[model samples]
Target: MTTSSSDSTSAAASQPGRFRVGVQKFGSFLSGMIMPNIPALIAWGIVTAVVVNVSEFTEAGWEPTNALAGVIFPMIHYLLPILIAMQGGRLIYETRGAVVGAVAAVGVIVGSDHIIDQFNAALPAGEDQLGYVHMFIGAMLMGPLSAWLMKKLDAVWEGKIKPGFEMLVNMFSAGILGFLLLAVGFFVMAPPINWLMAALGTGVEWLIDNSLLPLTSVLIEPAKVFFLNNAINHGVLTPLGTQQADAQGSSILFLLEANPGPGLGLLLAFSVFGVGAAKATAPGAALIHFVGGIHEVYFPYVLMKPALLLAMVAGGMTGVTTNMLLGVGLQAPAAPGSIIAVYVQSLGGGVGNVVGVTFGWVLSAGVTFAVAAVILLSSRKRDMELGDQFSAAIAKTEAAKGKSSSALASLSAGVPSAAADRIRTIYFACDAGMGSSAMGASVLRNKLSAAGISDVYVTNKAISSLPGDADLVITQQTLTERARPKEPQAIHVSVNNFMNAPEYDEVVELVQQSGDDQAVAAGSEAPASSAEHASGTRTAVEPRVLTQDRIRIRAGSATQEEALREAQEILVSAGAVTGDYLQAMRDREATASTYMGSGLAIPHGTNEAKSSIKSSALSVVRYDGGVDWAGDQVRFVVGIAGVGDEHLQLLARIAELFSDESKVAQLEAAASEAELHALLSGVNDN
Candidate 1:
């Protein structure tokens, strides 16, 4: 989920007497490693759910079909372990480590009583027993061990190995270390791990026999919100479910964490009764949660209102109870906790299973909504006016769009004065480092560049991979607790919208006014040109490309092209450009619509039309009645006039501004050039 970076500091992890931060960090890293393997895990589940019903083949007189199931099961059985081990090693030391981890896992795959007996004694008649190697267990153990061993060997040989023969030494070193770990896995680890596995299975069976399985949600629901769901689901529940499925043809364990009912119920309730952005964001999240199977979407909502955790717990227990009462289970795991995926996995379990799952979903949703509504209504704080929350939440919702919500109600609360300034390095973090967080980092990097702050290095990282040297940190509100424990010394800045100009402006001002108390960076020299004016203020200049005459508000036009033309005329009238640039703009539009989300569109000419430009300029045309641009209702059309690459930075700033709904709302409502110019003021290109 996307949230303002501003609300991060108040996360439970940031509070005292909660779970230790280190444990949370480990959970984040472990889950992150397992994230990429979910599809493969679900594929295995699908085959068991849809394709491996041997009885159906026998009834259809297609005995050969059963043979296909036999071939697939073995591969599926070993695939998860191999992949998990590979990912685990890759996380630690990259490709070489992954290779060593995979090689070492083979020993664990075959190390058990059956394999051991092959060398000791022959089996009696009718006793062709299978090996009891704990594949998942062994992989988890040997993967890291082997990777660590290989890393150590590399360190020892780093300078000793001949330069020309480095490849030979590195390859041989990894191979030898992996071989050693394989021996350890088979001879020293397998038997005890198998015993532990058996004990866990038996205890779980005991709980199921007594109808106490649903109580597990007391831990599961809370852990999930804390970003520990992957560890619990993949590392714990999945292995248990696989065992039950192997023995009894299905497992309720598979449905425990994957059930979508609880999250859906919470979202549905928030959509109806939630104050602020919660009401607007919840319904969409509900659909995504239940249908799209991205359960992560709802975690921030739960985190926002910790009381909602109870609602989730109650709903989870209800789903588990319903499944238990109906004697329903899935043949395989559901990849996403989505209803569609659950239904697909339920095929092997029959009509009863589908009905059970549906009933559980409905019951859980009903229960959760009731519980959540009661909590929201009863728990209003003295300082908080419910109506004010709604208003503030809406603006934040607009600013963040659909990414994340405020994790804390008091996002503007103060931090320690000693830690407020003098940050030399900035890190933008998120669940995955490749998406919005990366864009946020890029935005900040450009801002710092424009400010002539060459000493401050800006970078992006996954929440789990934050470096020790980071001086300032930024992340979504939901993940603040998860990230804070990693670097408590850094000046953490939480924000609702990475693209919000005000938020960037605030950070830039903080960085500009502060001294660098940390050691001087290697490139502490100032830039050749700075974004500061003679008045001694560092401001974003992207909006400077616009003159007062270029900002206009007009009635709706007949078509998208007419709107584009109207905006084009603003730049022409302002004497910002010359020649026929309209065709190139239209030509660019023909290739792809310029309608950026959040009720804004940016129309510009392609590189081929650069010759038509007389100067670099930006124009804003607001349509009060709104124009339809490629099916999207656009209220603001930003026309660009570029000479060479001068407009690219302006374009980036515009994209950032449009991403914040509240800002877009203000821009759309502006009546004069001053209001429009003020709104676009702090946004600029370097």
Candidate 2:
């Protein structure tokens, strides 16, 4: 997992040079023949056998039988190699060692044939006999011989050999080592496999000659009707995995040992005949099919275009048949549905191995390629029409989540598309106008200006003194109270450290969409309360009756008078200077400052008991800013007086908000009433 991207790139760059071009392709084809299911090849191979045996049947189904058989099987033969190369290249990427092993297995088959040919040439002309025993000897042992030889070569190259590809290097490590192993393998295993292959071949020939020829038409006809190649590759085989081996019995063992799906077969076929133009999309498709560990990737591509499907199916069936024909069987399952596990199973020579496997893959790839090419060319128009659907399907994923959100869905003409324009704004507000009021405004203005949005501005003047238009409105909860009815078009932008984050952009997009949706619904519902009557000002959003008897000023313990005085100063510096008006407060204090203990307080006047604030709200101000509290530094303050009992629940949220340690710090250190206001409206309260 600790992969350095640089290293992986370099390694991948050097990978192709390891194998000569065609070797990997031909190797994949030959090795697959020894693995599991191959649908396409079975389709065509059955046809081929039937065609050669047609004259023997009393009824050949007229020329259609011969014509179909001729047309299908031959087509498969031409495209098989393309299918092989594609799948083989993928294997090379994941584990080169396994690939080398598979290629060596191919050599075994070739070596076995080579040995037999040498023997036949040596036989005296008059007595020469091409018999079942001769071929069986060569075929039976070829698989293991190839495997063991590959192992031996790998060993010698690692032990005695060194770097072979660099300039001045021997370059003889695996090659020379393999040649030696090849010689020893041919001597030890070829004779027996040759005889075995010959015997199996003859047996199959006799079956076709005597009984199969007559039934070939009937069997293939029904096969084509109800269960073509896909049924074998996808239908019966893939479902077998949900029933993965759990026990030690032969059934489970077989399930594990055999290749489990036909996914690889289909992918191979796509690569084969999907046309040069289609390959642009095909490589990504093939990789997903190969490594995503899903077999369904290629199904639709094949279904819409059978030529591709046939190429895969033919290669698959051919590989399967050859494996069985060669007596190669899996000991456990492997992905890419290849027979690499047979060595682990040590399931040497059987009724469905070498001959079955080798032949199956060849036929499967070839047939699949042929079918895919035909279907692709036929459906060219349909592909064009449905092209956009593919992108839509992929867009909803995490990989495309940003893509969809970023895509300009319905930008208005010349009205600055989201893609074209990035909107930014800064709101400036202060109560009455002075010290910290100007400080908070200065900080925001400088930050936004540094970001190149100097067009934005913030101010501390009363609404009466201020201009009517602007973009954003940053003010204290109390200041917003004094400033009313201006810049109705401005956005309530959140003031935070990250106007630069991805999430910020996402939030902006959401706000934009929400604005649009709200605009459409605006015709039905009128705007809520205006600035004077703005019920939803930051927090405590509820329909205020604006009834009488709601006190405005918040006070804490008399023991903390010093802390209150400092908080008063901070709030005052921020332009929220208290105007008591004062003497009215002194006259009322004879009764109480509303310091209702347990760290709570409410200070108010007799005359302005119904002191109207925009919100019938709750406020908690800590006097760490300084308060004269009977020598105690009052740590928390709650100013509350509700017109009705309904507003009591609002105190609960206010208490919870004040209880948080982070909120306490911000409240305690507030530079001005307006800074406290901005903090709440921008985040803490929200």
Candidate 3:
């Protein structure tokens, strides 16, 4: 988020008349908008109480209360963490799997705790075991995995499984997921979690004890308001919940389990400074701060003020450092937090742990705010200067969007539809009309614009509702498999990365092979209504060399520019010109050159503009020596294409040609035209 605000207001105006930033706010805000994780959070909460409180309630006289605590605590203990995890997933994934990831927090906690317990038991001299430190270490990893697992599971259950059977299918599907999840959590995550918790706990516990106690009133009180107030557990701490961590000042550590991490400084800066920095992300940031209590929004500010990073770094150290000095301890897991939990932990510190981290946060924030404010002001001035330039550019682009949306709805990779057949369309299908398909649509929108490709990309659920000649489903690999229609005139090909990863190669492949591969990618042996994989069924026709073919390409100087021009002209001469069809070459070149940077340049683009496989043209341009492309001198230009208008056999020839980099290299080095032609002839098109 950048530092630019539309409204200037009071800092103390809790009315959000200003703004706020920080991690707790961002995490919670994001996690909340995402799917609700109530079920998974509930399940994980059950696990935490059972495991953490099981030993505490084993007493004789206190058995009932302890047992009761055991039952309720784990479930509640899990809530904050689950919330934290779901928030983390939302920030990182932002696509469909956010709420669904709540289940993973359970596994992260369970697996990490078991491993940490083993280590705590092993520490020498019988020092009291550290608090639930394993949770923090595991929390980081949970977000990414939760995102992947949720996305993966979502794909399998909703995409591949038959409709009406979704619920039943998901039951078995979730089981498989659960088993795999448990296994990875146990074997893969456990060892690392144990080591990290041990490491982090060593420092974190020290902070909770001597350091946090002395500064409570200052740090904990304000932090409670600023951080995760929901986790403070204000009532539960009055009487110690049964846990060995209660013996000393350990309860302070227990409360940290539920409280939000430090975030006030970040919130203040983002709300004030980064006003218009990230418009889309800002609303989410605001929600996370106000309600969700995720404090990670501070991260982006940290990203901005890298020069003044020491302030935050110093603040965190002070938080951990002061806790160490205060000599407080806690038994409960460090949850994402609620206000009640923070209060109890502060109370548990007996005035010491509360005081230390308390002052530390203030001193930290005061120093951090000052630093962040200065940076924000500086950036604001810079932004203001750039505004006029940016505005004009935006307006120019905006005016150009004339009929772009309609054009998108009428996109075709081939030559703009013949004047007689003016309509060309593309459809995007996915399980949930809102999730992967939506993401794919966004990506394809960008791709189509860049490649000069226009096609109507529509979501699946919305597909049946509309009326049109639209078919040729563009969707995830699995959805096509699961939604197999009985009398399938609609043909589908596997799309990955929401169409972004399909990139030039995959997109061209999907376009050219659209109707033919409905089953093979599904791993279908061949359903009764099946068609062979598109690539395998095309008729092979001999490729005719149109120009007695002695092609020569060279990059003597200004490599990329020269290579691009030469290659484009060659392709155009070879019947491949269709309104800047060379755009892919431009796209890849701009993002990253295909020069491989090793005395070579491989310029390529989709030949979907053609009806025949006319993409089988190889113009080998060997510079006398080389040209500067990136850092290397490109000696060869390996032009590649996916053309369908040429002949069916040419597609196989092109694929075969690309497979042997060695042959391409040999051709690149060839001094004589005959040698390069011989090298191209070596690969037979079947």
Candidate 4:
């Protein structure tokens, strides 16, 4: 069922091609900083648009009212830059880095202002003073730079401080570093950044003046397909566009990458002329792409046939040219590049502006649709002969994006049954392959083993290390997107909690069904059912892991962190692990929630912290009032410290005990610690 033809494209994405890895990583980093601050940018845009008309700003002797000047100017000059710096700093060193980054940003802001004031003072009496230079580029540079320096400084004396003087030394060192960085940012960083931004702005203006701006579509359309749309639009273009908009009240740069017309047209062409699953899904994908503002929906279509890239480029050029000729522009960056966002930003520029922008969008889509239709028609015979390439296209798209996309997943929902039958290798991925993914892999492995599904190879891996040949990939919902690109062929699954996700049972059922289907297809007697053997062996045995003293019923409610600490204290008190393991548990939870679903959460230290383990042990606590474990109601909390696979036997038994709703109810209703212990220990008997 796999498309062998896509192997080349998939390999290309897995390796490197025209795009440099360093450049992509840098673009991703820039978008990471800018994406979080988009709300602030949008708000600033709306306020500016509403306070004074953009058309009026173009007239001679025009000036903003005090309300507009007071709110609008300060937001671009100060608030936005500080927020961007804080986010950039946080990315580098967490909250402490964020504080230092903000401090450093302020220094650059004031320095740029000082430079502007000096230049304005030198201007002749009749000439207008130069506009204030926004320090966006300065913030982007100083934020991560200051935070990284702070981190390096902290590493110098880490764990070397004397007992109680640790706090004093840490506080003074960070303060001194922040102060010095502020001075450096003021003197050394601001001037060059301001000049660079000005130079870039001038370059963009030159392109527009020469009517060569449309040619940028050659780069932008291709980059968008490679998943650099956000990085290009939000990271580089938005900052430059915002500056232009502040001065001119509108900027064509905002429309450069944010125009949704080309994507809409490409999707429209697919809807009309595509084949198989792609044809069936194209209409829906087009809707999501054009109006929903998720441009990713169309990327897979382009990746399916890279020849379509030319069509996208042509469409993009047409949009840009139309906007340029009509003198139409957005008051702000049209985030998500949706038609709605474009129209909203086009307001306050008068009816002519709105009409012109709309016309440009329509023309772009029309041109792309025409070009893409011709391409699709030309290849219609070959495409039909090749069968559906939708799945392969999705794989390529995810590979290029460096992550799985939900939009792409929705397109392939009709064919899960086909993918399920071929499931042989499954991967459980997480940020670090040490804790959550490992535990999840263990749980799924146990399930598969019980089902006599020894043919399936299940293992845990860091998302970055996923092998491409996996048939199925399971990840935390938050990380599914990140895990997708690593193994584009895998049937990716997302779960809320790794421990007891309900999806586990469904996956087991799917495997069982697929096995049966394969046996029937081979025209042989189906293999003996393992379910009977598994169910019939429910006999009681002495509980080595669950002692009466270690079980607690009707424990008081606590926060998720407090519950984790309680679990850690119990394990520590039992002499199973060192006190340092508590921090490891906290660190593991920070990476991913330990919630196991089914009113159960198993809190454990990471694999790296296994050195702190003294012995294998388990502690169980039942919170009748219920503990909120990361938005899930948890009635049972289990703390585990395993030497190796010794703890997994009991852990598997616990998973089985929680798998049934009736048994879970019995455990929950247990009145005393002894009753709960007996009920838990009964899993071994079953």
Per-residue alpha-carbon lDDT of candidate 3 for residues 529-572, written as tens digits (9 for 90 to 100): 11111213334344443232526744344435456667776766
Whole-model lDDT values for every prediction: 0.66, 0.35, 0.43, 0.76
**Poorest lDDT segment (10 consecutive residues) of candidate 2:** 242-251
Estimate the TM-score for candidate 3: 0.33
Tens digits of per-residue lDDT for model 2, 1-686: 00011122244653542332233333323444323323433333345434544544646555766666556423332222223322332222212223333343344445655775777788998876542121111221333344344444443433233445432232344355445544654465555655544554455446434533222222322232122323232222222211111111011213221322344445454455443334344555556544543333343344334344344444444444444344343322344433343222323223344344445444544555555566665765676676522222221121111111221121111122222121233334332222222233433333433444333223333334446443344443223323323433332222211112122233234324333222222112222311111112333435331111221223333323223333333333333234332223223333223332233343322334334222233334544433443222345544332342233234333333443557657655666556655444422222
lDDT of 4 by residue, 368-483 (tens): 99999999999999999987878777766765654445676677567445565776666788765544565677678678778776555566667877768677788876566566
For the record, the alpha-carbon RMSD of candidate 1 to the native fold, in angstroms, is 16.8
1 against 2, candidate with superior lDDT: 1
Error of 3 at 512 (Å): 47
TM-score per model over all chains: 0.60, 0.25, 0.33, 0.76
Task: List the candidates ranked by lDDT, beginning with the highest.
Answer: 4, 1, 3, 2
Which residue runs of candidate 3 sit more than 4 Å off their true CA positions?
1-67, 76-170, 180-189, 202-323, 327-357, 365-686
Any runs in candidate 1 off by more than 4 Å, and if so which?
Answer: 1-20, 57-64, 113-134, 377-686
Best by TM-score, which number?
A: 4
Query: How would you order the candidates by TM-score, starting with the best?
Result: 4, 1, 3, 2
Better of 1 and 3 by lDDT: 1
Question: How many clashing residue pairs appear in each of the predictions shown?
Answer: 14, 121, 100, 3
Better of 2 and 4 by TM-score: 4
